[model samples]
Target: MIAQQAIGLIAISALASACAPELYKRDGIHPAHIQKRQHIPNVVEDTRGWTFDQSEEWNTQSPGWGACFAGTQQSPIDLQTSWGFAKSSPPVFNYPKALKGPLNNWDFGPQFTLAAVADDNTTEASIQFSHDGVEETAYFRSWHTHAPAEHTIDGYAPRAELHYVHYDDAGIPRAVVGFFVDQATAENPSSGSAFYKQLESLALPDIFNNQTIPEITLDLNLAISEVNDYKNFWTYKGSLTTPPCLEGLRWFVSKDIIYLSDAQLESLLKVSTFGARPVHRVWGHQVNA
Candidate 1:
């Protein structure tokens, strides 16, 4: 009986060894998804908060939907002439000191207010600006969705985009600048830059793109590359370029134009409607050469 029992036990042990489930091996853990855990830093979080009184008092009402637009003086004007060397004009800035209080108190820096305006006699469109500060500039070009127009400049090919400018009640001119870009290249001059890439990598909300969450990180450093050259530019004082257009802004436009590849221009047009906004008249503001 003892020998029989021993044999049975041995058989059971052999079966367990052959059929036992594989040891529960643990798999490597992955790093947390940065996008899932990232947060956008509001640079002007502590700036003076905007109240109903402030908005009403300054005549700077916020846009209800689409874009929270602002009304100002010296809105964007049309670019009718070809690119060429012109005489310089004296810089005339009489920015109101009191107006700085309200602007400086706001939370964000200049918000991008893009408008596509008619250029010259062609059906071309371009972007305009209303930025905070003495001067402002942006590279304008057709996104991947649009074709590039040939021009004397290396990177500037005419597409449909214009640049504009304006000023708030405080006497500070809202510098509207435009950048002409080509989208064909993989390198994104603005978002692709090292700094902007970092901010973009953060995957912040695209306020314009249905607040769609971005997949890539955002690099804030690209802002450092803003053009400072004001030698060649158009100068004038006009009204807010958009609806409810008010008057009284001092404008300065850069003479040097930026370029974008074909791909970039099309990408912009695809997102926004093919036509931005039409360029308004220069309105009697002195066009200083």
Candidate 2:
């Protein structure tokens, strides 16, 4: 059944390309095309040789950043304390009940959804879905933290926002996904790939300068197409990627790196400075490649 579903998805992707060349691409559906990426190593390596003149403290404090700086078991590094584990287990639901609407009917389970945006100058991305019937939203934004240090994700350039999961009325997470944008190539508007083109269509204009671009919404189908293979993700329990730094949460990040044009990335930086948080501690969590 899963095999059939995969085949069907591929067919649908092909059809989408014919229907909307600007929205979907023929090459965006392949698992091999979307390669896994390394954030920590990429930043530390600095193959681009970008300059970093800001003080360690200033850089760390820059607009958006955070991680497990206290050396907790957390994988990324700048988080605070561990909530330990929940003693009382969450409710469990039967298969029949699970299929119902608004996951709230179920006891506990993980759900997935896709989001994307694109237009003239910017591309915005996010995932919106209901978990346990509770609806929540997670979008990309520039994030940063102090403890660790100053660093940036290449291609993505300056920063990218990783909106932590949002909770439903029941206090359950509705979604968990990260947002990222990188420099687009001149040859291509963004990645010159079908996936990037899909997002460009929904691009939003800048607020300050109507002529300038701000951020645009990413197409859900295109975004999912970019990361179809889930095997290469890093999974762990941690806190929200934003302030208030809530702890005790599950995080799954794909090792796969998505690309955009440099010009597209520069447009985003114009509106927001840094968008990523520092690496938090691994917290004894096994990082599966």
Candidate 3:
């Protein structure tokens, strides 16, 4: 009987191990959470009335659910690569060498805002692209990360997603580039592995709070170029994935998948919840690749 009990214990241990993140099997990354050994003062947990936990309720619970559920161009629609066409050209990024800002945890997720004017008052980092034969430029506003990816590629969601928000000359959010992120395991070390590690190391504020971090070590040029080839992406007319779910925003979801390392992701999960809203309908919007 004692021998049979030992075998049962082994089986339970095997099952538990199998459920761990597949990347942790070989990468012995350090635990990234703040412990009793380290602490911050004057920091508070971020708060929010809307959460991705109850995404279905977003249509009614959120104050601006009218557009979120009833709108025709709601964002984060599944992108089909086969829809590629020659009618549009990919946007050209004028991203600078570096950026400095505070990392804040808003209701959606951890947002690295573009400070001072936030996403509205700056054209420092911008993207230039042609849509419908009209050339336009959109300035870099801010960027954020979400888990399980907000946009799915051909109906399959990736491990994570990164969004770079851009505003027009009038300070209106006119463009956003969405990149799917995969886990960088030892078997497949991703181009974004180093970049993401740098971001994960910074001391961060709790959810809904903001922490002033020093000038970041990230290089905007490398961050995007390394992750994507910059030529292959899908463009469409859509709305905001968050509250108010405003419509008429320009979207460029990339075909290239960026890879975030295990350590980087574990650190993020410590501060963020699943942020991908449920996929919306295309409503006849021409998704040009």
By TM-score, the best candidate is 3
How would you encode candidate 3's per-residue C-alpha lDDT over 1-289 as one tens digit per residue?
9999998986544332221011011112223322211222212221234566665665685343577678888888988777763356667878777776555554335666554343344556888987666888887766777777989888999887878877676545678888887877687675456556667667765453333353454556655675555677788888777654667778888787777666666677677667788888788456772
Worst 10 residues of 1 by lDDT: 100-109
Runs in model 3 lying further than 4 Å from the true structure:
1-48, 59-64, 85-87, 117-120, 185-187, 206-217
List candidate 2 stretches off by more than 4 Å.
1-169, 172-175, 179-181, 184-190, 193-218, 284-289
Off by over 4 Å in 1: 1-75, 80-157, 160-174, 180-209, 212-228, 281-283
lDDT of 2 by residue, 149-190 (tens): 222232222233322232332223323444333444453244
For residue 286, model 1's alpha carbon misses the true position, in angstroms, by 0.9
User: How far in Å is the alpha carbon of 15 misplaced in model 3?
Assistant: 50
State the RMSD for candidate 1: 25.6
lDDT against the true structure, per candidate, is 0.30, 0.30, 0.63
Q: Write the per-residue lDDT of candidate 1 for residues 69-104, one digit (tens) a residue.
A: 333223344544453433543243222211100001
**Deviation of model 1 at 86, angstroms:** 7.1
Error of 3 at 233 (Å): 0.9
